[model samples]
Target: MNKRISTILLSALFSVSAFAAPTSYSVDPTHTFAVASWSHFGFSTPTAVFAGAEGTITYDAEKPAQSDIAISVSIETVDTFVDKLTEEFLGEDWFNAAMYPKATFVSTKVVPKGDNKFAVTGDLTIKGTTKTVTMDATLNGMGEHPMSKKQAIGFDAETVIKRSDFGIDQYVPYVGDEITLRLTTEAQAK
Candidate 1:
C-alpha cells in the first residue's frame, strides 16, 4: 500500500477501536443476584431471594445516556425463608406468581449524577404490572480479571418501590409498603 493510504487506514482503524464499546455482556448468574427486604407484621422481618435470572447489560462509560440494562427474574424461584410464607407471598396476595411468573427491569435512561454515580430510570414489572422506578447507581470501577486478564466493570444500585402500587396490598397495617432492593452486577468484556 502507498505510505499516505496506509497511514490514513491505520488512523481510521485506531479511532474505531477507541470508540468501539462492548455492546452487551451476559450476566454471571452465579455472581449476580437481587436481595430485597421489608418489614413483616411490623415486628418480624422477612427477606426474599431471587434466583434463576438472566439478562444483558449494555454500558459505555463515555456515553452514559445510551447505556441500557435488562433483567428477567423468575417468580417461581422466589425464596422467602419459609415454605408457607414463600408460597403465600408468591401467590395472588403478593407477587401472584401463579399467573405473573416473571419480574423484569429495563433501563430507560442512565444519567450521570456525579462522582461515579448515575440516576438510572427504568421500568420495573412485578405481578404483571409495570412501574417506573428511579435508582441510584454507581460504577464501582473496572479492572482486569486476575485469571482471564479481561476487562470487567462492577456496578451497584439500590431502589425502593411500593408493593401496593403493584396490587400487593396484603397486611397493610403490619407489613411496610416500601420495599428496598439492592443489586450488584459484574460485567466482563465480550
Candidate 2:
C-alpha cells in the first residue's frame, strides 16, 4: 500500500505546470482527478470522482493566452461509492457508458484573470452533446519539487454544468440537474 501511494505521488509530480517558457505536461492519474456532485433528493449531495484523466497541457508563461489544453476522462471510471449507483450511471438513464465512453474538453481560449488565475473557455463534449463551458482556474503553486529537483506546478479549477443540457437530466429537480465539477492537478515541466 505504501509503495502504491508513493508511485501515485511521483506520477502526479510530473504533472506540475506554471513555470518559465512553453512546457508540456501530462496529467498524473494518481494525483489528478475530476469530481462531480449534485444535490440528492433536495436534501443532500452525492458525488462521483473519476481518476485516470489522461491528457496534456502546454503552458507558455510569456503568452498565457496562447496556452492550450486537451483532456479526456473515461466515464467508466466513475466511483460513486455505491455499486448500484455506479451501475446506474453506466446505464441508459445516465451516462450510457456503453454507447458514449469518454468525456473530453478542449480549450479554445485562456484568459488570464490576474495573479495566476484564468478563465479557460472551451468545448465540453459528453454523450455526443457538445457545449461551451468556462472553468475558473487558479495556479496554486509553482517552482521546483524538492525530491525530483524539477520545476513543477499545481492548480485548482472548477465549473458547473446542467446535466439536462447534456441530455442526462433524468431526475430533474428531484435529483438535481446541475453538476459542479472540481479538479486539482499537479505536473512537471516536460
Candidate 3:
C-alpha cells in the first residue's frame, strides 16, 4: 500500500512538470526590427519601418504552448521615408499617436507546426482598438550573444492585417486596406 501511494504521488508530480516554464528573454532593440508594407493605388508599394520595439518573451522549447510573448511598439518611431506621410500616419485620421501612443501585442496562444515553426495568435491593440491577429513565426536560431554574454534567440514572424479593422482606414479602399508586416527579433535571456 505504501509503495503504491508513493508511485502515484511521483506520477502526479511528473505530470505537472511536463509543461515546464521557458527561459525569459528581453528584446534586444539593436537587433530587432518591425516593418510594415502597404500598397498604393494597387500599383506601387511603400514600406514603413518601425524604428524600435520593447518587449519580453518567455520561451519554452519542451512545452512550446507554455511560452509567453509580448511586444510594444512606439508609434512615434514610424518611418515612412516621406516626411509628409510620416506625419500623416500619426494624425487623428490614422494611428492618432497623441491619443494612443503605443501599439502592443500580447500572445494568447502558440501552436507548433514542427520544424521550428509556430503559429502565434494574440491580441494586437493600436489607437485604442484591439483585434485578434495571428502571425506565422519561425525560431530562426538559439545561441549566445557575444555582447550581452547571455543565451539569445532569434525569431522571424510575418502577418497580414487589415487597416480598416484597427480603425486606421483613413484612405480606405483607395489607400489599400491590407497591410503586411515582417518582423525580426533577437532577444537575450534575462
List the RMSD of every prediction in angstroms. 4.3, 10.6, 6.0
- Where in model 3 is the C-alpha error above 4 Å? 1-21
Model 2 stretches astray by more than 4 angstroms: 1-20
For 14-72, candidate 2 gives per-residue lDDT tens digits of: 55533346878776667788899999998888999977687887887778899988887
* lDDT to native, each model: 0.83, 0.86, 0.89
TM-score of each: 0.83, 0.85, 0.87
Across residues 62-179, which tens digit of lDDT does each residue of candidate 1 receive?
Answer: 6778889898778888888889988897777788888988888899999998899999999999888899999899988777767668877778889988888998888875788888
Ranking by lDDT: 3, 2, 1
- For model 3, name the residue pairs that clash: none
**lDDT per residue as tens, model 3, 1-190:** 9999999999999988786668999998887778899889889999998756899989988888878789888888889999999999989888888988888889999999999999999999988999999999999998788777799999999999998899888777987899998879889998
Count clashes in each candidate, considering only residues at least 3 apart in sequence or on different chains: 0, 7, 0
**In model 3, what is the error at residue 15, expressed in angstroms?**
16
For residue 1, model 1's alpha carbon misses the true position, in angstroms, by 27
Best by TM-score: 3
Please report, as a residue range, the 10-residue window in candidate 2 with the lowest summed lDDT.
Answer: 12-21
